[model samples]
Target: MAGDGVRGQETAVLAGGPADGMRITVADRPAVLQVTRPCVVEVPFGDVRVDGLYVYRRDLRVDEEPLRYGFDPASP
Candidate 1:
């Protein structure tokens, strides 16, 4: 994997670090990265293969509003 998080022929894997507080996995239907904790994730300019993926570009906002999604599952 490239240290710069850029694409080549190799791929980069994102997962929980040694601190044991993160769990990286893919979501279903409306595809989004579901991370267990608040951590900084960097992806290379490579292939992001999701089986049934539906994603928007970084510029797309929700309801034409600012990006205001949180990871807190308890919240409404």
Candidate 2:
């Protein structure tokens, strides 16, 4: 079980298999996704269903440098 301020509350349970790779059910939904590769699963806010699943492959490339973040002493 996990709680997120932006996502409200969510309970993720591994329906079967090991922790390394398995199907996870989010919010007790019927749709279960097998996490075999690197990807990002997006679900609608305050909803149990998965809105989208984006898979990251090796073919993808990053041509531009990512933005850097610096620590701010003023921020608590």
Candidate 3:
């Protein structure tokens, strides 16, 4: 499971939006997040929790390269 994807409490990069390229702490393994009430994740900047839409795009073993949220505007 070392290179299968991002594990819990790991830093992942934001795919888009204002948080794009920003790093955040992943609270859940497999990165399962609700798009409806979207979970608040802790960003590296002052550990502030940002509220936004996060969709699971893929899994990566590399740090700061994995996408925590794709934030597709077309999605409902």
Candidate 4:
């Protein structure tokens, strides 16, 4: 989840899909944001009552050039 200062805050993210090339927008007010990587994640074969799932990968991209901060699941 990505957010501003404090322990609890709102977050948002832009997610993408694998085969279908679908995009998901995550906006959680007063909560946390979750972005699921399509290729690395395992989606259920059938209709599942879950948003999405991602496999923990060490090679995950954290930040882009000029951006000091990086994307770390352990952080926030």
- Comparison by TM-score, 1 against 2, better one: 2
> What lDDT score belongs to each candidate, Candidate 1 first?
0.29, 0.29, 0.52, 0.31
lDDT for model 2, please: 0.29
Query: TM-scores, in order shown?
Result: 0.17, 0.21, 0.38, 0.21
Give the residue spans of candidate 1 off by over 4 A.
1-32, 36-62, 74-76
Q: Against the true structure, whose lDDT is highest?
A: 3
2 against 3, candidate with superior TM-score:
3
lDDT: worst 10-residue window of model 1:
51-60
TM-score between candidate 1 and the true structure: 0.17
Tell me the tens digit of each residue's lDDT in model 4 across 44-68: 6675444444322222253322112
Tell me how far candidate 4 lies from the true structure as C-alpha RMSD in angstroms: 10.1
Residues 1-76 of candidate 1 have per-residue lDDT tens digits of 4585443322112322222233222222132333333333375436553232222221224422232222333322
Question: TM-score rank, highest first?
Answer: 3, 2, 4, 1
Between candidates 3 and 4, the one scoring higher on TM-score is 3
Q: Report the Cα RMSD per candidate.
A: 16.6, 19.7, 10.1, 10.1
Count: clashes, candidate 4: 0
Error of 1 at 35 (Å): 2.4
- Candidate 2 structure quality by residue, lDDT tens digits, 1-76: 3554233223333322223223222332223233343334564556344422322111113222221122222322
Q: Of the candidates shown, which would achieve the greatest TM-score relative to the real structure?
A: 3
lDDT of 3 by residue, 3-74 (tens): 876455656665664445666666544444334344556556685655565454434454353445554555
Instruction: Give the lDDT ranking, best first.
Output: 3, 4, 1, 2
